[model samples]
Target: MSGLAILLLAAGASSRMAGRDKLSEEVDGQPLLSLMCRRAALTGLPVYVTVPSDAHPRTGLTGTATTVPVPDAAEGMAASIRRGIAALPANTEGVMIVPADMPDLETQDLMHVAAHFHGGDGPILRATSENGQAGHPVLFPKRSFDDLCELSGDQGARALLKRDKVQYIALPARHAITDLDTPEAWAAWRAANG
Candidate 1:
């Protein structure tokens, strides 16, 4: 089966970054969002990014990851997911959702999630860390379209996973759950995993 389309969530307010936008931050000389877009592109599936309207174009995501503006981004992360789901192509089979701050995620890990999604195998599928911890870049089959569209505020897909039909796929990489939310976590992630 073809891989799932990816939604790169980059529209967060980044209030914890202390006035810095984590997406625009440099990781190995490339903007974090740019690196994430490149990684998502490796699956050969079209990628979409939810970002603020005033976000810098230098992030290299302007044309590649179709930029869906989230006017209420300050409200929370779920708004980004809502906008991303709204902007998905009509033919999108399923969506593999990943935050742009998780720049260290490799293309193979994404493919691993997509590979687990199949017809009648359930709509909700997620990647688990090596020690059995659930993480992001979840694969949501078309069955949850309505729920995804209804998301708002800071509450993400957490509600959908409670529907009992969700399945799990363990991807074994710690980077699967690693997101740069604070300076301390960012430094620890870089030092431990990068």
Candidate 2:
């Protein structure tokens, strides 16, 4: 099966964390990026992370595969998506775009999203929280590659969600929309999840 390749976006500067790199932060003794990568790997899918060139030395996923330094990441997430898409293997029929900060995303959730894509029923498959809030790790048909690459600034695929062809799969996990950005949000999420 030519499964959807997962592009884990970890290039953000985390300005809200105020000098701390959130992706490298430890959750239960594991770097957030490493845990997310490991979790994604459980699905037997090819998982690659896009990290800044100067990220701290973190051994948690030392030998894991990754792509370095999205040149336009400072411009925002759309650039990371474009860089990831550009680096994809020729056999990658489609992709699942995920943010690095979703520490609570489970393998079953990813499998659900990918299954929706593999079913050949939807052009775009979005994962939503049970409460109806749409979120990341969205699956895009190969046809959207051109538009995704052409996107700029902070847009990051929100426009694509507005398209008529987009369909959604509601996931029971609340982690679908939660991420640790500010220190308070991080602490709160940690406390809640713990």
Candidate 3:
């Protein structure tokens, strides 16, 4: 074990997708949330998945990952972030925060990030596009857990990241930044990548 855990944020309302729950959307015959969880699990790290509630459909698809229901998930990304961080195992020394909506993020992409985490102490590891655009699956050391838990609104950890030293790890193409939120985005991603 890398003394690390994966936090898959799936509590978002996906309001941008109208009535569609983007996490529940199909990705290669499985729910996007399920695929993400499986990918995270493949890293052999503990995974904590946040959902709107225990009854939400996402909870059913979590598979081996732990389910953390954020009753205040409507309050936005921070609610899930705060809740997910608290749910990680007691032995976790670092966390890789992955948004569940990025269909292009494969198991290898996650492993690439996990491979860079060095004993839970060092500069934060943030995945970047091949062209150097800063993006998702940020790996934070144990020292930053409090700051992450203190985050608010839908901004996620952008504020905490700005205050810390972040080392960027380049992933192929726009894999780091390709998060599909709206129907149009999904359609375009499907068309462009298919």
Candidate 4:
């Protein structure tokens, strides 16, 4: 895990949550952002969380995980990813990017992806549903960092995953596809799994 870093993306404005800040919302008595950061820490890998400057004070993320502030978070996910990537250590071999809204994303799923990342020229490992739908916590090798840095707008690294040269490991986990972006989605998740 020394070569791999976990970048927790928490910089979004949560526009679909009906004025609510999804990261501050509680799941099992813990804030969702804090829970995700803790889970990322469990792998013993370096964890960096990207939060909007305004949200940094209330994120409740400390300790081994570093908080990266994206002043232009409103620009979209690319801004957060750029900030996180820019903060990475020069020796980092890869990065696992996980969204803070994925409430059901388990530590085991992250560990599984991290464990599968071989150093040097390795494939992008993405968590997928049982039916092969790609999901969050995508692992990108150092070779792809440049491409990731060039991203703009709301686009993520999904475009990089489609490259013919890029190999892929599809980890099967139902929770990987579950994200609580809206109030209804959050309520539904809480109702089903709380």
Give the candidates in order of lDDT, highest first: 3, 4, 2, 1
Clashing pairs in 1: none
- Regions more than 4 Å wrong, model 4: 164-173
Winning model by TM-score: 3
- Look at candidate 2 and give me any clashing residue pairs: none
lDDT per residue as tens, model 1, 135-180: 8778888778778889877878788788647677776567678788
Worst 10 residues of 1 by lDDT: 54-63
Give the poorly placed runs of model 1, Cα more than 4 Å off.
54-63
TM-scores for every predicted model: 0.90, 0.91, 0.97, 0.93
Candidate 2 lDDT score at position 32: 83
lDDT of model 4 at residue 37?
84
Better of 1 and 3 by lDDT: 3
Q: By descending TM-score, how would the candidates be arranged? A: 3, 4, 2, 1
Assess candidate 4 and give its TM-score to the true structure: 0.93
Query: Distance from true position, residue 76, model 4, in Å?
Result: 0.5
Clashing pairs in 4: none
